[model samples]
Target: MTPRSVPHPRGVRLVEGGADVAVYTESAEAVEFCRFDSDGNEHRTRLDQRTGHTFHGFVPDVEVGTRYGLRVHGPWDPANGLRFNPNKLLLDPYATAVEGGYDWGQPVFGHDMNNPDQLDESDSAGSVPRCVVTDRHSFDWGDDRPPRTPLAETIVYETHVKGFTQRFPGIDESLRGTYAGLAQPAAIEYLTDLGVTAVELLPVHQFVQDSHLGEKGLRNYWGYNSIGFLAPHNEYAAGGDGGQQVDEFKALVKALHAAGLEVILDVVYNHTAEGNHMGPTLALKGIDNASYYRLVPDDRAHYFDTTGTGNSLNVGHPAALTLIMDSLRYWVTEMHVDGFRFDLATTLTRQGGDADVHSAFLDLVAQDPTLAPIKMIAEPWDTAGYQVGGFPAEWSEWNGKFRDDVRDFWRSADSVLGTVSQRILGSPDVYEPTRRSPLCSVNFITAHDGFTLADLTSYDQKHNEANGEDNNDGESDNRSSNNGAEGPTDDPEINDRRNRQRRNFLATLLLSAGVPMILGGDEMGRTQGGNNNAYCQDDEISWFDWDAADQGLQEFTRMLIRLRRREPALRPEWYRRGPRDRSTPDRVQILRSDAKGFDPPDWNNPTARTITFVFHHDDADSFALLLNAAENGVEFTVPKAPGQEWRLELSSDDAQRVEGKVTTLILEGRSFTLLRSVTRKDVRGWARAHGYEVSSKGKVPRQVQQAFDDAHR
Candidate 1:
């Protein structure tokens, strides 16, 4: 009630007297903060004080869990992007928690349907969600600390919060498909077992299930169409309403941190659920349309749509930038999330009609103390242009080139050998000029927008008809292969080949030099039945199947990740510049099947399918990787050390582990193998050193077991 009190931050801030509510709107003629009682009756209060662009007011005796929204009275001129209609209630842009879902049938449009030039007088109080007054300082973190896994050592696991646990048998039925489900013992155990340091959840922010999807009896399973940036999606919380999501989300973060796992949210700050000028007025559009969205320069009635989402948020505006920054900080300081993956991130860096690395948004992130240390990832491209390695040194980008090259190599596409080499070697051609290390490139073969690992090797084309788009919605060029037959087959050979290819892709992803992000259920061979784009298939098509999981593939993937962690050579801190000498630390050597150093002529040979990589680390065990993608088996000349022998560690062909002296290795077609060098004395004197514990059965001793545990730990 006092005008002299300092204005609270955006959104609801509980004060000693009542609550201080503040909202930012530069062009609104009048801002009315409306609160609704449990019976749905509304009490309106006009904000009496204004400082700069922020409007603030204190409501006396107002308790927590109060449902509120805003009604802005301003000029409703769509042609100039001044769409403000008091008849439609708007959710607070800074709302920490939302209380309801959107109804398409409700009169939520700011402009009249029949006469586009006139403003609609219909009230949207029943259709829009209410922002709740929250006390974010109440949660007890109790010594919870982020894992802060170094980027070089971070292995990301991309998963959907609800789809990840919706059918997980080990989780309680009541908690399944909720935030609590992700923190369940089984879920943590699974992530830890998979050896991933971080989990990049597909959009947990409050998102909209598009009305078109609703009409087709489908839902936005990916949750990319976000409307609320500061709030966690209320649907993911197990119980309670309003601000309860704040506590539930914090609890999830605590649990993940307790298990040494980081959480990264896939954020959609590039666009909102509110589409183009024809779309409904939700929050930003109804409050300050011109300031929030980027309208066409010559024609304000249309939007400067770069995200293909009909409208793009006008980050060019300081208020818009502040909104994004505030939301990010709230998630970090208040909700305790580890990082964010900006979807269509290039759009955010566009200033003056060009993607500038020194753009205001990136500069804000670089200068901010709270955001600089946290993990920042960028999808790195928008619908307008691709800026694959254009992000600054402070951030890591999803290496789209890595995905395509890895897929091409496994699919046996021609002219892929050269591309694959550069990709798996941390993509020096892309990130070297900036002096960035391997961690700058987040390597992933499959992501949420495309096919699952199983489907990638099982179907050559996308079967997205289930998405109700007549198979025209998803990408056409999948860069995938079916090997022999499409879909599920009864032939043992075809099925076996598919499984081998899957393992090959997974091995390539984990063993490559960079941060590898594994698609969550890919370890268990989770499939979308060939639906490469399952954005709208919220049913069984998108939900992870727990009962029929491929345990073998899961275990194989676990082994691969463990191998990656154990061998320091696999994950180098710096970009490899070739071996200075044989004894140099972190030496990288590329070779052909003939044991010859990577010859320039051979690099361009289309028939050159077999390549070997020898990685040497002074502080850890060394490894040699052999890749064969030809039609016939190839005999590779094994490199020999002066006083050491090579030991077969793992093979994609199910080859038996060989321990005796070997001069040459023969790999099967399209298979790979890993070899480790051991001192000749250790191999010959193993029985004597172990005192008969090491039998002729070729099993490693307890020393190796301890080493393995230490590597994984």
Candidate 2:
């Protein structure tokens, strides 16, 4: 007999005269609700467990400031990812605010791991932080229009949340390093002043610390690990009064939008911070691990280990996909976020059937009219599956080739000029015919994973000692070259060269034919103390130093961004294919410093040091850029054309080295030149810098002088 009725516990689904907010619990052998009061007073409510539980009745009069938590019960299985102990007290996965910090006690880790399932029966009672209830709603957001900045026009600044403002003097002490800090007039002004069109935040979702990092007295600095999809990291929001993180974050977004900037989140849907099969049994694992994660292909005993953190999310499952899609929609529709940069996106497209490039996950996102209109970016690669330009249309991917080629040209380009040409034109060979637009490629030199522009010119190899991994971590071959020294010095010659190289790289980025992304602090010269993977340090080493600037760098950065916004050609869309479309050549023209016009460059050309490329925009518009990366100057000549005079607007050889904005005469030598257009008998500045040389019949000399005169225009 079913024992007439097993004494059912008392419960409440709708708090008497309360609001619509409700919480649910999956298992309920033991569950209860506790409300905290300001005067240290507390209220208790019993929830029925015998009948099982999924939701807690909504309580009223509970506005913005509400604190509550749950008590649960279950076996504390460790190896199996099941850590349910009612005594320890757990935070709600949907929690917006949390009380207390990681106590670092044994309770923090689900299982003793060492104790083994054969040993400890300890409940780890009285430990673990509790979740706080948050009553979030709409904001006034007047005229809070998203920048709606075109992907092609965006220059992203990837940065850590806390590190960005904690030391910023302009932000209030309490607000510094908080979502509120990012919204302060000062923070908003800094972004606009610096000219970054979008701020690609690392991650905002609540996440767990890497067990290794936790034991080592460190924490995950980069927020790549995620726990709850809808919940924001409480640590990232300031003035944590009654779980106000949601409001604070929304406020920050509104402020950024008001400043004419967009917010692009670096989202990690690839995996959860919950590690692999041997990891802790958090919400998902506790609910249904087999369903939420891709169990190692055909091996049911293991999880797909593509995320490096140990497990890959199974987007193939509807519930899992719902979680991700819901989170994305909430951020876009509810929070009004501008876009997302999917980390290790290739992993998301892998299907058990075919792993089609046009997978279901992508198909859904692309078809969603509302979501499709937003800026969609993809990291596009990962360790398990690296797909460079393989993502479908309606998305822009980080062009690793752009990073590599640009790095080579300036660092090792002296020896590999051919590779440089392929990159400057948007890596069309790799991304074209996919029918993807040119803007689909996000070109960058230094990102958060590699050395900053400053370090690229300062350190030839990664100095990852600060990462506590002894120099074994990070990329071994960065294709980087320090003009002379290793890190820093007072050697004026080397420093000058390094600074010039930085200028060259930045200029090239703005001039390229793809969406450009500028790593944060690359402008003010931020360093990770040579720690390329400083994802564990939350100190000054990762922060953008507010004091390091010499005026020259700042002006140069600002002017470049403004000019980038000026030219339509620089921000060209995908090359639409048609009869009118320019049939791109396999290898086009590369004008040598001494050459007159376009011709194929010889890799065996032992004497060649500088090569200027003239990108022909299908008989419509063409701009020629000269790069004399050699230590000394090269006497470049303007090739014979319609004698069109090439007017030089920007040059690195300017006496002031003023960048960003300029209106000056054409300069020469030891300089990189950007010329607009030219006319008949108009030479693109050739001989004057090297001084005049004797010519045959005096025509050649005069011709060179004519080039110089054109250059001076």
Best by lDDT: 1
Q: What C-alpha lDDT do the candidate models reach, one value each?
A: 0.84, 0.67
- Give the TM-score of each candidate: 0.94, 0.82
- Evaluated at residue 46, the lDDT of candidate 2 is 48
Ten-residue stretch with the least lDDT total in model 1 = 577-586
Expressed as tens digits, the lDDT of each residue in 261-299 for candidate 1 is: 999999999999999877888899988888888989999
Best-performing candidate as measured by TM-score: 1
How well is each residue in 392-469 modelled by candidate 2, as lDDT tens digits? 877889988888877776654455566665567677777776766668888898888878788888887788886777
Candidate 2 at 689: error in angstroms?
36
lDDT of 2: 0.67
The runs of at least 3 residues in candidate 1 whose Cα sits more than 4 Å from the true structure, single-residue gaps closed, are 1-8, 577-586, 656-659, 679-713
